[model samples]
Target: MIVKTYQINGMHCMGCVNKVQKAFISHNHISEADVNLKNASVKLQMTNKLQLDELMDVLKNIGDYEMIENESEIHHNKFQLSTYKPLLLVIGFILFVSILSSYKTSFQLMNWMTNFMGGFFIAFSFFKFLDLNGFSNSFATYDIIAKKWKGYGKIYPFIELGLGVAYLLTIHSAITNTICILILTASTIGVIQAVLSKKQIQCACLGTVFNLPMSTVTIIENFTMILMAISSLIFDFFKQIIT
Candidate 1:
């Protein structure tokens, strides 16, 4: 048997490891396959030498997994802005739309913030809704709440959707902002831990569609929402006192 080692990109948790392992072993040529989540590498013992393309083809239906040459390539892939293009594009689009919606006579900070948060949640939740099972599996890997109760992962998309609708409607601002603060704060804590621990995992921010690696970017995304929620809450409080 021939043995080969390859670095894999887009693997974040044991669920990914299991999926990849199954994909390889499903192939007749690959006799044994071992996927290492910690290192994001895979070892295969095959009866015949398998080309990288051929091996990659096996994972086409599974998820956004890619085979790389080495650890350095993994690091290189992680650091490149192109690697995060999808996420950046999504945020940029949301910002544009939010500004457009809020700017009529002049720039309204509160309106813009509300529109931005609404767009952010709706867009992100849409992605999660695309593949709830996939998103849940990925989310449970890093989310503190999802880690404890797998059901939370499944329900998270609905919560985001609800928050988005609430924000868009501009109803019960105090309660909505409070919930947002609590949820995102909890999320940020988990993200901070993951980033500090230097775990090479997938970010479920865009669900399973975009293969985003967990990084400071993920922290910023969560933190920004938390900040917005806090700002909204404070604004509402002062507005209440004034009126």
Candidate 2:
């Protein structure tokens, strides 16, 4: 068995690894593949000779992946930080702004959570709008609803934008919070399944612009919004009870 190593680009998570491995292993010439997400490379044990073009064709069928044979440089740790910097920066900015926005109101917990959810939806939706088609394709790779109905991926950003506006305007509090719970709960189920199944795929949470990998962070992002909505609803219910 001849072992060949190829440097891969655009692999941000284990989901990407799973997809790449599947592509290689499905081919008759490729006996086994060891996909290293950290290193962004794949080691393939080949039972027969295969050309670079052939391997490239297999990846092309999968998604947006670039491969280079004979390039074995590992910068997995650095790659993670660099890859997720955009997402982290956006999250930090959203949190900071959300907190700042509530300062004038004396930092009421519910108000702060409202602003945070608004900021989260608006900011995340902005990214998705950048490349709607790309985001839809990537999102469909894992999102159960999107996978079944491609139109859901296309319209999801608009839904988020609407929710953001609703929260920011503080309109229809009960309805808005309820929608948040339902929408995010469905999304969280998909994220949890993708992570548990170890599918190597890109995360569409930040859209196709950032090469964010499918991971636990994506799960937390979904659950955070869900929790915020649930907490706000609970607080309102108790306030109503006291009054």
Residue pairs with backbone overlap in model 1 = none
How close is every model to the real structure, measured as TM-score? Answer: 0.74, 0.70
Tell me which residue pairs clash in candidate 2. Answer: 14-200, 15-199, 15-200, 15-201, 16-200, 16-201
Report lDDT (Cα) of residue 70, candidate 2.
63
Mark the regions of model 1 whose C-alpha exceeds 4 Å error after superposition: 1-69
What 10-residue stretch in candidate 2 is worst by lDDT?
Answer: 71-80
Which window of 10 residues has the lowest lDDT sum in candidate 1? 69-78
How high is the CA lDDT of each candidate model?
A: 0.85, 0.82
Tell me the tens digit of each residue's lDDT in model 2 across 63-125.
Answer: 899988663323341235566788889999999999988777776887888888888899999
Tens digits of per-residue lDDT for model 1, 1-243: 345689999999899999999999999768899899998899887544456788889999999988975655445755677878999999999999988886675887998899899999999999999979878877876788888999998999999999999999998999999989887887888888888877656788888777677898888888889889999999988999999
* lDDT measured at residue 127 in model 1 versus the true structure, 0 to 100: 96
C-alpha positional error of residue 163 in candidate 1 after TM-score superposition, expressed in Å? 0.5
